[model samples]
Target: MKNNSAMTKIPKGYTTITPWIISRNTARLIDFMKKTFDGEEIARLYNEDGSVGHAEIRIGDAVVMMFDAKKEWPDTPAFLRLYVEDGDAAFRRALQEGATTMTEMTDMFFG
Candidate 1:
């Protein structure tokens, strides 16, 4: 008998994107993603008061994890590492659209 299975095609490197939530505006972040990156919400967990406890979004072929800040994790800032065709252009657009700059776009030895 011949084994015939549909092989799954995968990207060269696939990774999940997780962003920390510190601002009081998790929902606004969701909206920003949709507007900025055309992200679609996949799953969302919310508090009783409608605050987002967690959320998953799919932007293009990548998945992004997001969540609201909890009292327990008071100091963790949202961190995201995204790979795009043009990092400089993306960085500029993000800045033009009001994203708070933690670091300016620079080519590093690691990147």
Candidate 2:
């Protein structure tokens, strides 16, 4: 088989797969990521009207992309599972940061 293109398909320093989150409030989501999991903003591409075209946030070794949703685009919600060093402490921190608990924390085989 021959190569698909001259340039590399995947960008350097990026994984083969990345989760892209579309939200109405991209800035708020980034802020929440920072507060909940110590996510750091890596890159941001903004639109002419000031809306976020695309943005990247890094939480530990994982990188999550985000973009501001517009009226034309279909609204799709994504649920992310993050593995942290301390579950109890992370849960408490999330709650303190205004996250409403859907389920209480408990020890499980799945971790």
Q: Report the lDDT of model 1 for residue 59.
A: 71
Residue 63 accuracy (lDDT) in model 2:
91
Model 1 segments more than 4 A misplaced: 1-23, 71-73, 109-111
Task: Give, for candidate 1, the lowest lDDT window spanning 10 residues.
Answer: 5-14
Strongest candidate by lDDT: 2
Using Cα atoms with residue i matched to residue i, what is each candidate's TM-score against the true structure?
0.63, 0.81
Candidate 2 lDDT, 1-111, residue by residue in tens: 887674477777677678999998788889888988999999889999889999999998889999999978888878888999987888888888777888888888997
Q: What's the lDDT of the predicted structure labeled candidate 1?
A: 0.69
lDDT of 1 by residue, 20-55 (tens): 456556777777777667678887888897778788
lDDT of 2: 0.87
Cα lDDT listed for each candidate: 0.69, 0.87
